[model samples]
Target: MKADETIVNGVRIGGAETKVGEDIRTIELPSGARAEVRKGYGRDLMRAQRAAANGDASAVVFALIAEVTRVDGHKIVYEDVLEMDLADVMALQAEVIDENFDRPPQRASQASSNPDSQSEH
Candidate 1:
């Protein structure tokens, strides 16, 4: 079987899968290797952001390492000693948020003006 061609429970695995969350889903490759789908990158990034905001450095680092490892398909070594740059994490979070929840660019004047109007006395 080719690297891209994988079979899981009689189903083929080629591209990335959608819908990842707390619930684990098994994916068996044609080579019989199994992988479980966990939380998505966006969700994991959000969780790390929350943890970092709450002053939990360890949580932030762990989340970052887990995210990078998952994306790079590299085995995580020295998991306990994993470190992450806060700026990089924040940038990635911003990118993900912008991509997922993008709003049309608003005119500057209209955006500055308040929606509520007051009656002149």
Candidate 2:
């Protein structure tokens, strides 16, 4: 098989069997390992942006790492990630947050996209 054929990207869990606050995504890493990345709701994008503004990428990486609930469906602690693995974790973190983050104002085309907005008949 070609090298590209082994990789699968953006695999996600659907249906009621999924958990309430956590969103799961699966991807094949550069290392060729399949990881089931779990992320949660309520990630503060403002805070993350602030941390990045401080010019400390490591801070953003660590902060995002905390939101990762598991790897391969097993509980993975922050310590389990090696220094070289920070990039991988960051990518997965983005997936987790992206899966749950709200669509930005510019991205919304309909009032119905915003739950609090009332539509007139």
TM-score: model 1 vs. ground truth: 0.29
Backbone collision count in every prediction?
A: 1, 0
TM, every model: 0.29, 0.43
- Please give the range of 10 consecutive residues that has the lowest summed lDDT in model 1: 72-81
What lDDT tens digits, residue by residue, belong to model 1 across residues 45-77? Answer: 664555356657655655443443322242222
Clashing pairs in 1: 7-30
32 in model 2: Cα distance from truth in Å?
Answer: 1.9
Candidate 1: RMSD to truth = 12.5
Q: What is the lDDT of residue 101 in candidate 1?
A: 45
